[model samples]
Target: MTDAIADAKRAMRAELRERRHLLSDHARETAEAGIQAQLDALIAERDVRSMSCFLSTTTEPGTRKFVTDAVARGIRVLLPVTRNDGLLDWAVATTDGDISEGLFGLPEPVGELLGPIAVNDVDLLVIPAAAVDASGMRLGWGRGFFDKTLGSMERCPPVYAVVYDSEVVDEVPREVHDQRVTGVVTPTRTLTLAPTRR
Candidate 1:
């Protein structure tokens, strides 16, 4: 992590954010269709219902649609609540209508917060990241929320960070605290398989 590398990383992130905001009106529609189709195939298979999933939100390229669709199909949906402790609290969102934003810009359940659940119960976690590499190392918003929550998992629940195709990179800065995702999914590719053990 030299000064030059850090500067380059910051510049890359800024460029990405700007590009994401400039998507053509048709870009989102195209992405939604492609994303939904890929996810549908994944859901149709038997693996989706095996365990609860933590469905997160995104600002522009976000895929709340995928989460709601899973709920409609009776797949268990877990939403993470950002806590004062700067860690994530996992609770079932139940349905699309069950969500609202918290004090921070992040979305949370409007109803009872409900106690946190065991990470082992989660089979697949649909995480959000600013960037993800081929090896599954993800660069997320520096708040360290996902990193903290992921630290609690007991070697299970394949993590998949959802991002647009352009966000996938060859490498991202990784720290001891940064969590490695199990895979990366673009709007088109259902899964960019990460080299990790199940």
Candidate 2:
């Protein structure tokens, strides 16, 4: 059952990737607007004094402007420094001018790399995702990076995953190491306190 489910999920992602580039201009514009609106609302409501968010990639939901805006709001913006040791480390820096491509061709900080910090120290964590279900289960880019890091954290901080409308679906397969987000902000909706059965 697990194998079949995994294969199905992988296939779904592959299919979507092939079609994502074909998105109509109207669709793209609408989605971007909705995402920006959600980000603005979230920013206004929170203190954001100590928030850490990942620099987004093309495959994942985009949060580049969100990160920059956070910095302008006097919030601490953090970038993930992927280490050869297969653990995620973070560096606190203004997501202003230091952004450059990293190992996976994803944008990351180009400044001093800071060491690991407790998960509890982060007031909010912005995670990337391919999809998220109503149960708050986040489906990342199939990389075990987040799973491995989150598996070790004791008491987790509030995590938010950004996703497009289509990716905010009804169900998704989960693994043992899969961590759930506290909420999801989609291009079209903010499913705060995701209900288990939504």
Candidate 3:
């Protein structure tokens, strides 16, 4: 990636982080509810039997509620465990799954470790993003784990990035390895952007 692009991404990510940090408690709760509803609808619409999702941090759009509910509904949900090799391992999400802080202080599931390839079996992927552009490009939180995973997938299912509605921006800085998602789920709605997956 060019220096200009790298700098742009860093600046954008910082700005988005501040925005998330500044969100009021009431706003966060409302967004969480809305996000859960939109995600539930997406699951129902796609009839997703199994999927991959991230355990949201306090500042990110809430996914813990959705994950627990999905597990209770008997849907197979795999949560990502960050690995030192810049890759991700998978773990089955349980209704009563134990969460521990993983690499980068991100919340991760504690369970039997499933290798990287375990994600290939998922019917959908709901990932976290700092922001997403209209054309589907996702700017993640400076980690390349999700990008690497998506790039290696032989037949990826619909990948959606969860963010607050305001995080749905007109554009985001991109590099050659940055992956595009199939859509984005926000507090207000779900939008299917044209995906460029191979």
For residues 15-65, write the lDDT of model 3, one tens digit per residue. Answer: 999999999999999999999999999999999999999999999989999
- The candidate with the higher lDDT, 1 or 3, is 3
lDDT of candidate 2? 0.72
TM-score of 1: 0.83
RMSD for each model, in Å, please? 2.7, 3.2, 0.8
Q: How much is the lDDT of residue 124 in candidate 1?
A: 68
Q: Show where candidate 2 strays beyond 4 Å.
A: 24-30, 193-198
lDDT of 1 by residue, 150-171 (tens): 7766666677777788888888
| Model 1 spans with C-alpha error above 4 angstroms | 1-9, 50-58, 96-98, 195-198
> How high is each candidate's TM-score?
0.83, 0.86, 0.98
The TM-score-based order of candidates, best leading, equals 3, 2, 1
Best by TM-score: 3
Ranking by lDDT: 3, 2, 1
Clashing pairs in 1: none
